[model samples]
Target: MTRLTALLLLLIAIPLAAARPTIDAHLHHVNFLHDSDGLETLLDAMDAADIEAAVVLGLPVTKKWEEDAPREPRYYMGDEAPVYYYSAADPLLIAALDALPAAQQRRLYPFMSGFNPTDLNAVEHVRRMIEAYPNRWQGIGEILTRHDDLTALTDGETARANHPALIAVYRLAAQHDLPVLLHSNLTSKRERSFIYLSELEEALAAAPDTRFIWAHAGTSAEIHRHQGALPKLGETVEQLLKRYPNLYVDLSWTVLEPYLLDQEGRPDPDWVALVSRWPQRFVIGSDVVGRFGNLGNIMHSFEPFLAALPSAVADRVARKNVQALLPGQAAMPLDD
Candidate 1:
């Protein structure tokens, strides 16, 4: 093609790239042992989706203990039946990133999550890793406290967000200026009600210095009890956001149906206004696990909702908000 033609094509391609640039505040590094794909898959998917940066956390607790348990296809959360677990200290995630050249790693903001929250020494476990690879680690968690179905699947002693052991972990995170991405389901997973949020409120109150990302905006996976329609959680979400300046919201796939969009894939005006009220407090997360077969379309899944938002509000929630939180933001590329 001629230079003039090539330039024209380049100009056209840029707008198709990112209607609004985005930072995936939440995503996972698929462990190749049990998953369909791994780090490279995620990297490629992120690029295709126009996701500029992603916060990748390792699974903190593994299901290795489920080895002797008989598999029951009828069990709840069946896909998560615990067969094997890579420990909280597993080097597999870091190793994969280490294998990549510097340019590739820049697109990823890795966080340390593979630590036992209930262990008294959990604080030390995270600290040692952070110290060992100071530059590699930017945040902590996706810490599973009240997560549905998976709660029983874990081998370690279960603890709530406000448990003493976790309190210590949060303190350690604050000391390092590492933001903690907590996955304490806002309400009871069974009841789908706002009963358990106080546990989160307690944790937030205790760790005033820590920046906490409330994954799924406290929403959990849908269960049989959801009764066809879920509660409108926008007001509850606003209350929490209003109460905690240190808190940020992760609007992951778990909340796509009830919290942000409707059955027709359109944005809810109330939800949009709630998010727009504090656009900086919210960020988009693909919430993909161990698979990138569809990651490219995950962030774009929110396009209709984003389109409904004011451009400035949409861009902030999509990209700039999370960018402000990243530790190595200065080194990341700003180009399409």
Candidate 2:
């Protein structure tokens, strides 16, 4: 091979190799039954896809379906029958992550969950887990509230972000300097209205110190299931970001599909501007629940939308911003 040809190839490879990882900030490692995937498999998938890191959390709520509710949720990926209620406990995640080798452990950051959010003691429960895995625990949540079918199936009062019990939990998060990832759907399947957004805004005001990762930007599959009139969330999100400096939006697949993309599958220029305007306030998430088969593709889906953004802004939304939110010890180094 000629020296000139090889030199040209090296120059092209250098920039590609140094590109940042597309972090999946909202993936689920555990659901009702248990931690379904092994850590090594997940890491290998990330490596193949060039995902530098991900925020791994167990679903805190176990769903209990009504007798009439179908055994398998229509959109669920796992082969098992749909869980009527998500099993409650953090042990699955804790035990799963604890068993990982030191090097593999560095690829994923663990977030505490597996507790009832409405319990006044939710904060203490999460705190105990944090203390148990000092270097392991980085954040708390995927806290399910006003969830679509889950809320419908739940027998008791569904927890809201503004609820005093959750308020207490936020206080605990603040004390520990940990970020709280909240999944409070803006509306229920039944109502199809923006009734619950006030609840979220109130909570954001109450705990000014707590950094929140708002999952799905209030979009959920249940929202689609009922197929009722919806609020213009894009405008609402812009306002919320302006109002709450502590809040970060998780642009998972739910939003990535219709909201962030145009009918033609192009990145909505408006979204590009919103992200670029507040580069540090937005992060991308795969929203994969207890499944990693498509992990790489899920993270990769955001690339086209990201490509529409400016270079530096694209890098921040892709990985760096979310890494900043992770605890110093648990956050991974950037590819650059």
> How high is the lDDT of residue 316 in model 1?
79
- Strongest candidate by lDDT: 2
In candidate 1 the C-alpha lDDT for residue 231 amounts to: 69
- Lowest summed lDDT over 10 consecutive residues: which window, candidate 1? 327-336
Which residue pairs in candidate 2 collide?
62-85, 62-86, 62-87, 63-84, 63-85, 63-86, 64-84, 64-85, 65-84
Q: Please tell me which predicted candidate would have the highest TM-score against the true structure.
A: 1
lDDT of 1 by residue, 109-141 (tens): 888877777788878877788877766788887
For candidate 2, give the lDDT of residue 270: 78
Please write out the lDDT profile of model 2 over residues 236-310, one tens digit for every residue: 898999999889999887777666766556788878888878777888888776767767666666766898988
Query: What is residue 306's positional error in candidate 1, in angstroms?
Result: 0.8
Error of 2 at 79 (Å): 13
